[model samples]
Target: MHFLQHLPHFIGLERLDASEIRLTQSVITTLCGLPALRELCLYMPSALARSEGRPFPNVHRLELLDGFPFPTTHDIVAFCNKFPNLRALASSAGYGGLLRDLTRAEESSIFPVLQEYTGTLRNLHIFARRSTLTHITLVDGFLFSRLVAELQGVAALPNITFLSLALITSESSWFDGAQIETLFTLFPNLTELQLTFMPTEPDPQILTWQINGSLDALLSLLPSTLRSISLKLDLSDYHDTRDPDLEDDFSLLFDYPHFPSLRAELMAKCPALTYILFDGYHFLFLWWKTSTSSVWEATADYYADARGPSGAT
Candidate 1:
């Protein structure tokens, strides 16, 4: 074990098809020997539903799977502790839920344990389901309120630097708007952000979100040092949902007056902001098609010059 220790910094345990408890044991053995390991990605099998607490102690980069089989609050908390020094985390689990659950849990809950290692954490990337719930719609106001409060409570992590959130269709509107607001308010040190929304129309229900909040809320929440923003919006409401092969129609949302709030806000609020990219291929196509010829010509010339050899040709 000692001879093979320094082989590499990343250790991936995937598709072993082992049970949760047994897999946990094997993982502990594999990771304990590699004290210097910094990156770890665990792809659990369908049957393996759980793992013991603190699977690793020094991992600086961690990625854990979610979806398919929903990850419970305990599973996430335990995983966080496994990497005490993790500065970057990209997970497929319910990241917002993990944060929310950690907050709502009692003082004796796993959040305190996570707090113990918060100093080493920096970038967090979450990919989970998104809901269409509105701010004014509340099932239990106190529950969500506490979740936000807890997020704000830890928003000031001294070492955190970047955050990326991908909200799927399963989550309510709360994740994109309110949850995002709470996150930015707390973590002012963030320098980069990537927010992606994937709206799906599954069987049994055909729900769509109509966001009433101003895009200003999104811009206002970002830190002053933020430098870039990337949005992937799937606005298919205006299209025929009945058509199985219907392509996403994002034009309606892109033209919304509030859509440019971020750009305007960045220009006004964050002087450090310099780069922006909008993905939503169809939307871009339409934008290019509708733009003035002068503007297009200028952009083409600028790119040509930027990539030309020694300013020639």
Candidate 2:
């Protein structure tokens, strides 16, 4: 028992995954014994502040796992202080639900040097105004009004090179695809992109999205620096429903008759785009070249994939 308690002091522990450990004061004291520790993963790390100890100076990468509620404003400050040199923050669970109460100074200082973040769009919107982040992945999906309205005083971040996010398909908002174009403009240097779609309502009798116009107006604005694009539909909410595949329709947008020509034209205009993928509905599109010119091609995975999208279920 004693050896187990003093185990950290004997070895040169450089990385730790304490996410499953019930972190206690003794556990924290054990952490202080490792000076070479540079990477860490923790779960619901609110107790770090209460344990009086010198901070880890070299820790730069932090991965926060979700089991309990997120650290509150009370613990957020001191918890972040433990890793003053942190540069990347990742969380599988959505982030920044209760952290909206932080003061301007605290918000600015939180992840002050962060260059990469993977979490919810809500938190990104909360911190984007003050962040210089170069890579972002928002799993919770984009909320347009919530992102732009709060950034009235902030300029678009050009340093970002990679971005992946999900957007809910709401006919009223996403019909023209203007929102996505605006998003591309925010990160001018973005090289790789992936966009997933989700239904706005959880279990509607029949879910449908009929874009009123062609998506070309938005595709025309694809960043010249962008090299790849991916679009997906998440039907996880319909796993147990009756006729799930046929009921949740997104036809007018994805199965537009002219999309093949549109893609060829768009790729010609952008020149830098090497791949355009439609991952949802089992559809796939590729960019290839002919003897004299370049063109776009479509590949399918199954019989359903080859069929055109349905306007409505």
Candidate 3:
């Protein structure tokens, strides 16, 4: 950590990637002294919950790769308050309950920490993963609702342009078309979006399933400014059921046979969209725009040529 003392002299250092190292008070303090440091990635230490350190006024981007101490909301609020100019933040959802608190209808006091970056904050990445079914049920919907509420509460972030949310859970209803629409409404300027939903079966009652809606109806709700989009939906559970009507609906809505047509439809509707990706059960569809073409060209000459042709299995 002593080497960090010399970092201030390298005044030109604008980005620091310390994801592989454990951060300590001494190390963090040393790095914060760097006058030109604008971007930093490191783990937040439990000690930070008690430390009264100087603010990183110049940092515009900060990524916390690990969970903070217990009561993560307080720690996250402290860090957000410390970095007044942060434009981008990436962290695990387990460590940032501040989002949930902000959306609470009973908490009337404004969050000064988040208010500090309202004008400059533009990107947010939140990732949540839980292997146990009990734990998943305890936090998945609650966290997601809080996220939505937080976004609804913050009306000052008009410049926000990128958002990514990845979750591993057993709840299929955690995010639906309505929720996606709500997200678009919250961040109207978003140009890029990525969503990965990995569903696990914890009990017979809880299985991954698709939301009821046509792809066109969902895609139409996206902002016109969107230039890139990546979506992964786990629909493998749809085939496990014995009901014929349910299977028919699932096959008609999201089966691989309809992807090429969906691709063409999406490109025509969203002229600014240059990239689209869909990865799921028996489906790996990708499309990108090329020069001299207003339409999206499929990655493979034919969908079947890309991989051995197969139906929803």
Candidate 4:
């Protein structure tokens, strides 16, 4: 009476119906013996059944969870040796360790064998302990930059049309203009870009002058092949005025110049920019006349009836 031998008695009866059956090695041995099982998954090591010199040949889509004790890369390599046709692998481990465990000899080895992978590689998610690190380490630390390099390193496959970067505003210095330029260069076919970041209230006067400049710089970094862009900035910080730098930040967030520059830049370079969502406001209809660009048009048209000083409106 071994532990795995008693599994089938505890199997599905009138009371037991669950799609995802999570079990350890002892339980799996019993579950696999059930001919009624359709799609089986082993969260434990693939080698568990093999240790007994038996194989569960029916389980089509296998997922290896993080419960295995394989510390080195070879353990993963040995595991994948059994499940040769595994289609997708999803893991929360570091990319460097994952890649080593994956046992991919080269770029082709990975894409061809795995076919479609949805997780970051082992080395892509590394971070520096301290604030002061060199450019190479900084570049390595950012996942998107590493992704760009990996995509470039790999041989031809289907073109990647869109790339989304999960950005932290605190990490903005890591993604300077040079890094952005390198990204566009690496992924020439990329047309859509999504950037998510925590917001900072730019200086009203400074933003009045620099917003468009920054927009222009960003636009210039992108390739001509790009047609659409979606940029998101988290404004939760914009509402907070406690910091010394952001003492008067609320004023900057609502400042007239900020919107004007944003409007002008959107009108100019992103002409094909079919869509734009700013803050929480959705600009569904944008009517920019080609006859003459008037900055005061919105001010006059909207505030014409208001009782205020002539210049106030």
Which one wins on TM-score? 2
Arranged by TM-score with the best first, the candidates are 2, 3, 4, 1
Model 1 misplaced stretches (Cα beyond 4 Å)? 1-30, 45-55, 66-83, 94-161, 166-189, 197-223, 236-265, 285-313
Give the Å error, residue 153, model 4.
Answer: 6.6
Pitting candidate 3 against candidate 4, the one with the higher TM-score is 3
Q: Point out the higher-scoring one by lDDT: 2 or 4.
A: 2
Considering summed lDDT, which 10 consecutive residues are worst modelled in model 3? Answer: 128-137
Give the TM-score of each candidate: 0.46, 0.76, 0.60, 0.49
lDDT of each: 0.41, 0.65, 0.53, 0.41
Candidate 4, residue 219: the lDDT equals 58
Which pairs of residues collide in model 3?
Answer: none
What's the lDDT for residue 300 in model 4? Answer: 20
Candidate 4, position 73, lDDT: 55
Model 3, runs deviating above 4 Å? 18-29, 67-76, 96-160, 166-190, 197-212, 235-254, 290-313
In model 2, state the lDDT of residue 39.
Answer: 82
TM-score of decoy 2: 0.76
Please provide, for model 3 over 58-153, each residue's C-alpha lDDT reduced to its tens digit, 9 standing for 90 to 100. 887666665454465565556556666665554443543444544333222222223112111111212111111010011132335656543444
Best candidate per lDDT, number? 2
Report the C-alpha lDDT of model 2 over 1-313, residue by residue, as the tens digit: 4544775875577778877676677767767667777788988677676668777677888888886654556666777777777778888765455666677777776777777888866577555654467888876765566556645555677888888877666645552456666676677778888777675653332232332142455566678777777766676666547445543344322442245676676677667777676655434444544445455465565436664432221
